[model samples]
Structure formats: C-alpha cells, structure tokens
Target: MLMILLAIASACAYGVADFLGGAATRKAKVFRVVAISAPASLAIEGLLLPVLGARWEAGSLGWGAASGAASAFAFALLYQALSIGPMAVMAPITALVSAALPVVVGLAEGDRLSATEIAGIPVAACAILLVTVKRSAGVGRVRPKAVAVAVLAGAAIATQLIMLNQAPHDSGVAPLIVGRAVSSLIVLNAAIAVRRRIDPGRPNLGLAAGAGCLDSLANLCFLLSARHGLLSVSAVIVALYPAATIVLARAVLKERISRAQWLGLGMAALGVTLLALG
Candidate 1:
C-alpha cells in the first residue's frame, strides 16, 4: 500500500515535469533542452545519493543506465511529436502505451488483479482518451503523425519501466543515477552529431532544468516503488501522470478544457483508487 502511494506520487511528479518540459520545448530546440536538462537532473539526483543511502550493484547500474537511455529516447520522441503536432492527440496516446506495456508484461508473468482492478482498466483507458480530447474538436478526430510519435514514445517509456523493474532491488539509487547520466550522454552525443552544434541558449533552459530535476526525483520514487510492489500495479499508478499534466495545462497555460476531459479525469481517479485497493 505504501509503495502504491509512492508510485502515485511519482506519477504526479512526472506529469508536472512532462508538462514543463513540453512547454520549454516550445521555445527552444529539443536537443538543447535535453542536453542541459540531463546534466541538471544528474546533479540533483547525485545530491540525494547520500541522504537516500541506496545500495549499489553492478547489475542494477547497468539496468538503470539502460532504463535511462530508454527514457531519453522516449522524451526526445515525445518532444519532437509535440513540436509539430497537437498535444490533445499525442500526450494521451504516449501515456497509455507506456502504462499498458508493464501491465501486459505482468499478465504474461501471471500476476492477477482483483475484480475491481480489472474493471478499472477500461475506465481508466476511457478517461485518458477523454482527457486527450481538445475543446476545439469533437470525438473521433486526431492527427495521425502525432499519434505515431506518441506510440513510439510510449514504446520507449515501456522499455524504461521494464528495465527498471528488472534491476536488482538491493542496488541503491546509484544505478538510476548512472543510468540517467549515460542515457543523457548518449542522447547528447546523438543530438550533437545530428545538429552539428550544441546550443544551450534555448529560451526556457531554466524551466527545462527545473523540470529535469523533478523528473529525476520522480524516477527515484518510481524505482523505490517498483522495488516494493507489483510492477503492473505500480506502472499503472505512475501512468496516471496525464491527469496531472492536464490539470497543469488548464491552470498554467490557461487552456480551456472540455467537459468530457473533466469526466475522464474523474474516471481516471476512480480507476487509480481501484488499482490502489487491489
């Protein structure tokens, strides 16, 4: 139960970071944002190492690094998708794909859920879909490219979850920190090769860096939760991040949300509650 709560908190933190990251990307190059943000995150997480006193193991370090690489890919794709497309179509799709993957993996591993939890899945799905709906459009209309990128992002996200879950439980947060650092370096190098320049003068560097710090914290919480709970349940709870993003959009961006989104938010909350109970 405690783990589940931690997972929910992770989701909240991730959602906020995502929202801020996305917003930051709007005014800056995606690669630049990533390059600056990654180091910023590493610094923040490094500071927490002593306080958290997490164990360190070679295997866990490798897995954490792998997860970090996957996360870098996911965020890069997500930022690219949002750069050219509508958030209403892309965000929810990515979130759903990422959330569903761990559940599928858990099912394959024979993890069973209670009746209430089973019922909550579709409700949560529907709610997520509803929240993605923009006030400008009615049901059944979405941009295809945005959807594609979102799906790819989700796949990367799922990979992160799977790798993180596979890491040795006793291995402290070092693995995570190392993983993130390696992933960031990989993405940074890739971005440099592609763009031929590393420009850190992006308008929202501070915001992106701040978001990265939150993201690092979220990852720490998630790793802790995964160590203590069912992977599927923990993943689903953490996936409720879209709810936080939607709320942030409405509040910070002053974007008008539709009635359906509100209803979806309610359903998502209910689904998360059921998941917790299970």
Candidate 2:
C-alpha cells in the first residue's frame, strides 16, 4: 500500500508543479521557465540519490537515458500546453491520455483488468473530448491545434512512465539520474536555440524553481511507487494529478471551468474509480 501512497503523492506533486509552471510562464518564455526548472529538479534528484542509497547497472543507465529523452520531449510539450491553454482542462486531458496508453500497452502485454475497468476506458475517452472544449468571450469552442498538441503531449507523457517502468529492477536510481540529466540538456538546448535566458528573472525565480523541485520530487515518488506496485495501477493514480491543478486554477487564478468540463471531470473520476478497483 506504500506504493499507493507514493503514487498519490506523485500525482499531488505533479499537479502543483504544473500549476506553478503555468504561472511562471506568464512572466517568462516557456523555454526559459523550463530551462531553469530542469536544473532545480536535477539538484533534488541528485541529493536524493545518495540518501536513498541507490545503485545502477551500466545497461540500466543506457535504458534510463532513453526515458530521459522521452520525458524531456513530453515535458516540453506539456509546459508548452500549460503556457497557452486553460490548465484546468489541459492537465486532465494530458493525464487521461497518458494513463490510457499504458493501460493499452499493459493489455497488449497480456496484463488483464476486470470488466468494470474495461468499461472505464470509454468513459475516460469521452471525458478527454469534453474537457478540451474551451471558452472564449462567453462562447464554448475548441482549438484543433491546441487539442492536437494536448493529445500528442499525453502520448509523450506516457513515454516517461513506459520507459521508467522498464528500468531494470536492480537499476536503483540510475534511470532517474540519467533521465533527468537528459531532460536538463534538452531544455538547455531549447532555451539556447530561442535565445532565451536560462535564468528566470527575479519575479519568476520562485515559481520556476518551486515547479522544478516539485516536479523532481513527483518523478521520485512515481519511481518509488512503481518499485512496489503495478505500473498500470501507479499510472492510474498518478494520472489524477489534474485534480491538484484544477484546484489551483480555481483558487489561484480565479478561473471557472465550463459546464462541459465539470461533467468531464465527473466522468474521469468514475473512470479512475473503476481503474482503481480493477
């Protein structure tokens, strides 16, 4: 059950980190925000590595580095989406898609879930469509480009899980170290390409660094969670991260989601409940 707790903790931390990242984007370019945040996350992960008494094999480092590349791409997309759209809607859409892909892979790999769990798949799918319906000037609408990116972002998000889950059981924290290092390099390169300063401006510093730390911690929680539980189950719980971002939107941004979004949220909850039971 410790895995369950860690999964939930990962979800919560990710939610808050997404919220903070979105807020930081308002003050700086997304690339700049991501660039600064990556190192903060790396610092935390580095500190925790020894404290956790982790060790890894050479092969695991190679594989773990792949996860880093995948996650770096996914996070770039996620931060990009969060910077442009309503975080309340975007967060859930990204998470649901991320969760669904792994479950599909699990099924393909011969893992089975109960019938009730299977039913949740459709419900979650509907929710993804419903949640992306955005509003502008009192009109409800959806942007195809943003919607498209959101879906792609979800797929990218799933890669992080799929790759990390494949880490050699005895790999210790090697995958995490390699993964985060790769992500940092990606963000740094992106920032350079855009001529964006890697350091956050004074106003953006706190939010940027905080987001990075939380994100790093979230990844740690998920990795530890996977060590104790099924990846499918851990992914499901962690996918609930949107809940935290939604709360932050309402409280911090004073944003109200569309009615359709609320309904979608309900459906997502139903889906998660079923997944949990399954």
Candidate 3:
C-alpha cells in the first residue's frame, strides 16, 4: 500500500515536471532547457541526500551511472523522434515499450505478482495506450526512421528504470545523486557543444528549474517504491503519469480532454485500485 502511494506520487511529480519542461522548451532550445533542468535536479538531490542518508557503494554508483547514461540517450532519441514523427503514434508506442520492458525484466529476475496484480497489468497497459495516443491530434504518416528511434528511446527509458531498480537496497539516495550527477554532466556538455545553434530567445529558467525539482522528487519516489515493492508494479503505476499530464493539460491549459483520455483516466484509477488491493 505504501509503495503504491509512493508510486502515485512519483507519477504526479513526473507529470508536472513534463508539463513544465514542455512549456520551457517553447522558450529555449531543448538541450539548453535540459542542461538547466539536469543541474537543478542534481543540486536538489545533493541537498536531500544527507537527510535521506546514503552509502558509498561502488556497485550502486555504477548502476546509477548506467541509468543516467540511459536517461540521457533516451531524452535525445525521444526528442529527435518527436521532432520528425506524429506524436499521436509515437507517444503510445514509446510509453508501451517503456512500461512493458520493466515488467519483463522484473519477472525474469524472479519477482512474482499476485493474481490481481497480474490482472491489473493489462488494464494499466490499456490505460497507458489510451491516455498517450491523442487520436484527436491526427496521426500523420510516420516515417520508419522515427518509429525505430521511438522504440530505441523507449528501450533506453526502460533501461534507466531497470538499472536504478538494480541498485542495492541499502544505497539510499546515493544512487540518485550519482545518476543525477552523470546525467547533468551529459546534458551540460551537449548544451555547450551546440551553444552556437541555440536559440537566442530568452529561456524560461523558472519553469525549467521547477521541472528539475519535481523530476528529482519523482526519481526519489520511484527509487523508494521500486525498493519496497515489485518493480513491475512500480513501473506500471509510474507509467500512468500520462494520465496526470492529461488532467493537468485540461485544468491548467484549458485543453479539451479527448473521450479516450477521459476513459483512460478512469481506467488508470481502476488499475491503481486493483494494484493496491493486490
């Protein structure tokens, strides 16, 4: 139950972060926004690590670093794919792959789920698809290259979560610190490399920094949830993040929620209930 609650919090945080990050991208180059967000996240995590406690374990740090690298690559591929492909098609594909792979990895590593939990998985998957699909947006012709890149992005996303989950239980927020540090460096370097091409428009630092802080919170919650519960469960619950994002878009941006999205939101609620009971 506690894990489920934590996972829900993680989802909400991720949703909000994504919303803010999306807004920030309109004002600045994607890489520039990420450079700011990554370092801001690292700074917050650094501040929280002492309060959360940590152990300097090489194995844990290594896993964290690996996750960080995966995350960096995932973002790069996701942005590139989204830039060229119709988001209506690519988003659901990426979400499904990211959610599914962790479940497979967890089960293969001997994690067992209750019957109810297993039943909820498909329900949650359906919710993910419905929430992310954006049928109203109209799926344009998706290029083969974009579809392939989207899949790779999803794989990288799953790798990040799986690697983070593999960190030792006793590592505390040490893994998060290491992961943020590595990702921050990568993003910062990328921003520097392409500084000349960056848009001269004023960047929205506030939104980017807020996204970073929320992202840090999301990561911490996910780490705790994965450590306490089944990785499959944690990943699925967290993947429901798109539902939260949709809701926020409706409420804050005054965007119309598609019928499918409304249904998906309800399905997400049902799935969460089932997982919690299981």
lDDT of 3 by residue, 44-147 (tens): 99899779888889978999999999988988888888888989888988888899999999999998899889989999999999999876456656789999
Clashes of 2: 0
The total number of steric clashes, by the backbone 3 Å criterion, in model 1 comes to 3
The candidate, 1 or 3, that scores higher on TM-score is 3
| Off by more than 4 A, model 3 | 136-138
Top-TM-score structure, candidate number: 3
Question: What C-alpha lDDT does candidate 2 achieve relative to the native structure?
Answer: 0.77
**Alpha carbon deviation, residue 63, candidate 1 (Å):** 1.1
Each model's lDDT comes to 0.81, 0.77, 0.90
Estimated TM-score per prediction?
A: 0.88, 0.82, 0.97
> How do these models rank on TM-score, best leading?
3, 1, 2
**Model with the higher TM-score, candidate 2 or 3:** 3
Q: Tens digit of lDDT per residue, candidate 1, span 18-105? A: 7988888788777777777889899998898888766677787778888988987887797777766776677778878988999899
